[model samples]
Target: MQLIFDTLTGNTRRFAHKVADLTGVEVVALADADPRAPYLLLTYTFGSGAVPESTAAFLGQHSHWLRGVVSSGSYHWGESFGRAGDVISAQYRVPYVARVNKSGNAEDVRRVADWLQTHAANAAD
Candidate 1:
């Protein structure tokens, strides 16, 4: 699957690039993505479980191609951490594929990579 990221502090972008490298998939910024191509969104949460406005805006016109979402956020938010991902998943009817803290760890990458393998294979069918 294609990867697209919406980043503010670069964490999401870095994570997306890492995933792209691991999966050998192409990645683009949300602003630069092809609206018609299917992709899994990588983004970070905003205040109190809010989706980033940039991601929301991009979804406004291109959500037809959105397949899943991965999110990054601070753990300090407790139960609210990564909650924006929940919102997006529910709103878009896509899977909430992964959640990471800050830039993510090796385990996070593994989890996402594993998911991509299975998810993509399922899609191909």
Candidate 2:
């Protein structure tokens, strides 16, 4: 799995590191990802519910192989509607998991990792 993000305050990056630690996935800045690998965009939401400008630009540049986007922080009303990148997954998909926090704890990340593992295993069967 490839984790991509454009972090300004490092909060998003800090959570990405936790994801890497749990899943052993490579964490890459949006500019450093391999275009061929499946991608998960990690971005922060602004008050207007827009993805960081840098992240939006990165996504525009590499619109290929973008499996899903995971936005950190609350979104403004009508902020995240209709933004699609192949497939979209969010906290709403799995309510059992907790949202990512600045403390570097992400139940959702672990849930995603486990879900991916199960999906891969099922595919092999």
lDDT of candidates 1 onward, in order: 0.87, 0.56
For candidate 1, write residues 1-125 as lDDT tens digits: 78899999999999988887788878999888875566889999998889999999888888988888999999999988988899999999999988889888888888888888887865543
Please identify model 1 stretches exceeding 4 Å from their true place: 122-125
**Tens digits of lDDT, candidate 2, 45-125:** 554545566776776677565555655553233534323221223422312222343323456677657754544433322
Q: C-alpha displacement of 116 in model 1, angstroms?
A: 1.4
Worst 10 residues of 1 by lDDT: 116-125
lDDT agreement of model 2 with the native:
0.56
Most TM-score-accurate candidate = 1
* Model 2 residue-pair collision total: 0
Candidate 1 whole-model C-alpha lDDT, 0 to 1: 0.87
